[model samples]
Target: DQQVKQNSPSLSVQEGRISILNCDYTNSMFDYFLWYKKYPAEGPTFLISISSIKDKNEDGRFTVFLNKSAKHLSLHIVPSQPGDSAVYFCAAGEMNRDDKIIFGKGTRLHILP
Candidate 1:
């Protein structure tokens, strides 16, 4: 069964605007959330992350918000740029439980000019 899910298979956002990618998880054991960005021919790279204890975390133009009650999380990229166009993978794991991380199918984000 899929523990994590990214409902939208693709998302298009205009450059210089805000891009929001959403994710949901059915496993309550997940206490850590992470966002990864992958390009055409490369492995996914760590973007941002958050813990269950925090509602939001921000780094540069990227931010991640986690809602434990809803088992939902989102990644927000402000002032979306052309370089931001990539497939974003949402991951969740239990920090204290194990090192296994469940990843979603990923959502392709296109930054349109």
Candidate 2:
């Protein structure tokens, strides 16, 4: 079974608008969540991360929120720019357990002008 799931395969948002990417998980053992952004022909780079102890974590234009009860998380980008267009992957794993992190299929985000 897939532990991490990104229901939306793709998303489109106009420039200067907020883009929200949603994700869900089935594993309650996950104590950490991470978001990664990848451009074509390039490896994914870490965007932001959140611990189960916290509900939200922000880094500049990106923010990640975790809802433990709902087993859901989301990434919000304010003033989405064209450069922000990429595939975003939601990952989750237990920090103290193993090094294996489950990843979603990824959601392709298109930032329109």
| Best by the lDDT measure | 2
Clashing pairs in 1: none
lDDT digits (tens) for residues 1-113 of candidate 2: 99999999999999999999999999999999999999999999999999999999999999999999999999999989999999999999998986789999999999999
| Tens digits of lDDT, candidate 1, 1-110 | 89999999999999999999999999987899999999999999999999999999999999999989999999999989999999999999988875689999999999
lDDT of 2 at 56: 95
Runs off by more than 4 Å, candidate 2: none
Off by over 4 Å in 1: none
What is the alpha-carbon lDDT of model 1 when measured against the actual structure? Answer: 0.96
Model 1 lDDT, residue 70, Cα: 94
69 Cα displacement, candidate 1 (Å): 0.8
